[model samples]
Target: MPGEDMAGGAADTGPEEWADARLRGGADAQAAQDPPETVRHTGPPAPGMVINARYELVAPVGHGGMGEVWKAYDTKLRRFVALKGLLDRNAMTGASQAEAMARARREAQAIAKIEHPNVVTVHDQVETDSQVWIVMKLLDARSLAEVLRSEETLTVPRAARIGLQILQGLRAVHAADVVHRDVKPHNVVVGEDGQAILVDFGIATFDGALAVTQAGAVIGTPEYLAPELFDSSAHGPRTATPASDLWALGVTLYEMTEGRTPFPGPNAWEVQVTIDTSPVPPFQYAGPLAPVIEGLLTRDPRQRLNAPEAEAMLQRLLDPRAAIAPTPSAPPPEPDPVPVRRRAPRGRRAGALALGAVLLAGAGWFALPLPGDDPDEKDGKRAGSGGSGTRERWKDTHPLLKIGVKDDQPGLSKFDPKTRTYAGYDIDLAYEIAERMGYARDEVDFTTVATDYRSTALKVKLVDLVIASYSITEERKTAPPTGYSVDFAGPYFEASRGFLVREKSSRYDIEDTSDLQTLQVEVCTARDSTYEKWLPEAGFKLVESPPNTYQDCLDKLLDRSSDIYAVATDDVILAGYVKENPGKVRQLENVGGAEGYGVGMRPKSPLLKSEVCASLKDIMSGQVWEDLYRKNLSPLTDRKNPPGLPDLTECEVQSAGP
Candidate 1:
């Protein structure tokens, strides 16, 4: 009947292709048939028919995946509300009907628990004549899907505003520990007042609650599912999180701007595979909101922008001043053209006397002048006529960019010996900077640097740059007993201190700093890292022998007999380790002191420092930085706090420098 023509004839095709098709219609779509039903009702209710006694169905207004809606009058309340019940319940037989009815009731229950303007409100639910009925606040609105159909695309600002509201609703839903498993444009309604409201909780579920759908069944629209839901081999069975809803929201936003979804294929399987394995297609019209869309669509649910993070990004887009970096009005320009020049020898170090003078000057130290510091230096050459004053740009002098990085950090940085390749956030970032600095991918080399040796690597010219998770501190900028006296550029990333504990260990429940103090947990962190100073000051006990790297701490945590109750480090770092050893390790929700990661270089190379800092600033303002972050870090953690562009004021070229 659902696929019938108005003339009471069987149509050639089912309503499955209709834009408003309520039932799942993808390739794998399936619904269990209901058991034979007992006589429940004589016929469908007409206008003014009071089947529930207290309410009368005035007219059918719409239908959803599992139910039909009607404009109804509440006789007792003396007001009108929207009422819902299983779609053609009497006509449906067997398990399919039962599941639909159950889902309808579940929707009622889920909406009733959340009270937010952006979320639909449930007023009453009742059972009459063996059918479940839900009463809800009537809203004068149209589904976003319908709006998009008429208006092929919306401006970036409008899409961001709508996305912000949806994200707000999601926040409230997640606060109640619920996951709106089916988040799509059809599930979002835009009201006459221009306020967007999230609706239809038919497939929503409480966190940790047994799923209402059949096991291993792929639910929701195929195009909107996060990678984890469909990619069985890579991510395993579906484990929906609030992050999943964000992914759907990302797709919805993409559609609002691009006039279509990111992944398009002839069949559902192909689309699913694309979503699981491929990067989001490049945006042609996303404009300033591209980063927000990219952040939301990250395949790694953990690395994906959470509700709060997404909301902040949207809010910033609406108010540009608050944005991490003012988004470019157009796509960023191509990489700075590389200059054709003779290559300098590898491990070429600047004069030691120049670096020593800057470092030995103590806390207020500054770069020293070189022969090329004359004011007349211009057109890529020195001011004076003599060859002695011929200035060399840092890129020309260092044709090969030698970067020191952590080989053990899982998501932040790691080396795969089998493939003889380095991969992770640090690795990707180094490559990005190198490209901007006019170096080819092959011209860049990565050297593994231990936590204690990051500065030494730079000081001794073992590496031209240290892109390891090197935190910037005043002590590190000063010379001698108190510090490494290393100069830094562009705090490219901001990391927060948090703890990682064995998932199955029952010795302690560390949720926050208060728990750490109460449980007297002995935490292990990488030696000479920020955590070493923060933990001891926060009253956390450190293991007698601290590990040389976060990986070592994770190893100690995995050993059942070790006294190390937890491993503490930047949440970004811990997230990777947790992902690398899933189920065996988990990060505590507690986030402590924050630190900004910077690129470490020798104190004398002010020219190179300025170049790297400028390159980082440019990258942060574009989509590539967001892409790199999503690729390397998003798959590791779901913590709501997302790092923004670091303040580049520290990157100002010192007047004392050549």
Candidate 2:
């Protein structure tokens, strides 16, 4: 039914009509008084025909398989509106008449509940003269089907703009618990002002409504159906979800840009088979928008890009700076390789050790200074060496750059004992910044730091930089007596605060912090960390004694005897724990506000902090940041929609001084 010529109007085949009839009632029913052949060939309604004493039909505009649309004047509202009624009920059996009426009522109900600018507005629904009619707002617009038939294709920017508006409308529909199963070019109308409005929700599914069609009956246009709706064995059942609508939207976008759907065939069955077995064809004209299309076209619904992620990508395409740049014919030469050097071990423990060792060794290490500490030293060799000093002096005095990091977090930062090397997102980022600052790879030292000691380690000059998933906060930036007085550079990574619970706790349906409070679940978080302050603010019940590190909280969660039901921290940190434990734990993301992880430094190193901030900005703007994320966190997190690069406006302000 979907692959038919839809340039003029929708034309349902015999099977689709029969499926609709079965949805209303059985096929054994009386026929209309008029003969079927006579009703099928009846002339259009006259231009001056009046309907329901409130509408005057001006002219017939279009005809569909089940109904016909008319440009009519609403006398009661003193405006013009689109009127739709059964094309010819007398031409079919009694069951077909009932099916057409039911479809009209369902369409009216679905569109009336959604009041977005991009969605069509419904005025009223009435039954008169043995015909069901729906009244809706009229526009000087044409269906996208007609436009596509004439123009063949559209520019990428224009298509993206239209796709974005449709996505917004779909989001509102989903928020109301409705799914538009029929989202194709035929259902979209583009006005003279270039505003795209989604119309025709005739086959939409409401949350609590009964099934409109019987089991195993194909509902949507075959060319636009999602992969899951084709074969129940390969990908789940044929049940429709919001993601199904997104998949249809992806097909529509592909058609708009390429002048044809990705899976093309001579017939509907062939198209369905191709969609089930073939990958999306490579793009020829879709340059920057290719990724968005690929994200939507992912066969797995779980990994496909959601509405918000798709909308963000479309918005980025609208930005002028996001235009594609021309590539050079020759490849750029690679940089000279930096020599490797064995790292000298500091007194602090490495993060690759056992959790018990971390809990015991990291408890009171921050209270005492390192063995070679000298309070009066200002030559940049010991603790507080560069206090209130110049960048040139600090760089000249320190031959090797020392960076404080966490070793236990699997994806963010982890230490491998077998290879005796540090690897993960933060590790790669540390190397990126160091290279940008004129330091060789072997000239850098990574020392494991506990969560609560990040700022103190920077203030005491235990390390030149702290990249241990350290969050930027006002309390940490303020001078001593009130706060830690630590300086922060770029917020290189953006993550949300969330909860990590054992898989068994999923039965509680704990979606957010409020759910945890209502369930009286005891939560555990690292002491002196940001979650320590946020947990009480969120009204969560904390354990009698909090853990000293994230791993300690995770340990408590793994122990059956412990009272901890969930571990609270940034989602990035929780992702690591989930990856390590596998099916044992899962993260509940976005339970709290977003937290930006920054590079922490001593407050006195202003010039050096500025340099690091600039380096971070460069890394985010290039492909290096995305490559690092894919290598480390993408497997554990949402690979289709990774976190966006954070805005570094604060870095500019900090660099300009107070």
- At residue 257, give the lDDT of candidate 2: 71
lDDT of 2 by residue, 1-658 (tens): 1221111122121233322332344332112111122121134566656677667666566665545677765655545677777334545466665665565566566657887877777788876645767777775667888778887776656677778778888888887888888889888887655677777665677765556556766777777887777767765777888888999999989888777889877655787789767888755445446656776786766445667556645654554212112121221222123221112234322321233233323432111122233221433233233356744433455556778888779889887766657889999999999988888888787766677656655543556899988888888788545235777887888888889988875346666667788998988998668888788877888776565478889998888777788999988889788888988888875664888888988775655676687789889999999899998999878675567888875587643231
Clashes of each: 11, 0
Off by over 4 Å in 1: 1-47, 86-107, 276-278, 323-658
Error (Å) of candidate 1 at residue 51 is 4.9
For model 1, what is the C-alpha lDDT against the true structure? 0.67
The lDDT per prediction is: 0.67, 0.68
The parts of candidate 2 lying over 4 Å away from their true place are 1-49, 86-107, 129-132, 320-658
Q: How accurate locally is residue 140 in candidate 1, as Cα lDDT from 0 to 100?
A: 64
Give one digit per residue, the lDDT tens place, for model 1 in 1-658.
1111011111122232321121344432222112112234556666656755666665666665555676765555555577766445654677666665665566556667888877777788886654677777776667788778887777555677678788888888987878887788887877655677777665677744445556666767778878777765654457777778888899999988777899866655887878856888755456556667777787765345555446645654565323122222222222123221122223432443343334323323112233333221231232122366555456565555778888778778888866767899889889988988888898886766667656655543446799899998887888646234788887888888778888887677666667777888888987677777778788888877575577778888899998887888887888788777888987877564678998988776666776788788888888877787777787776533346767765687543233
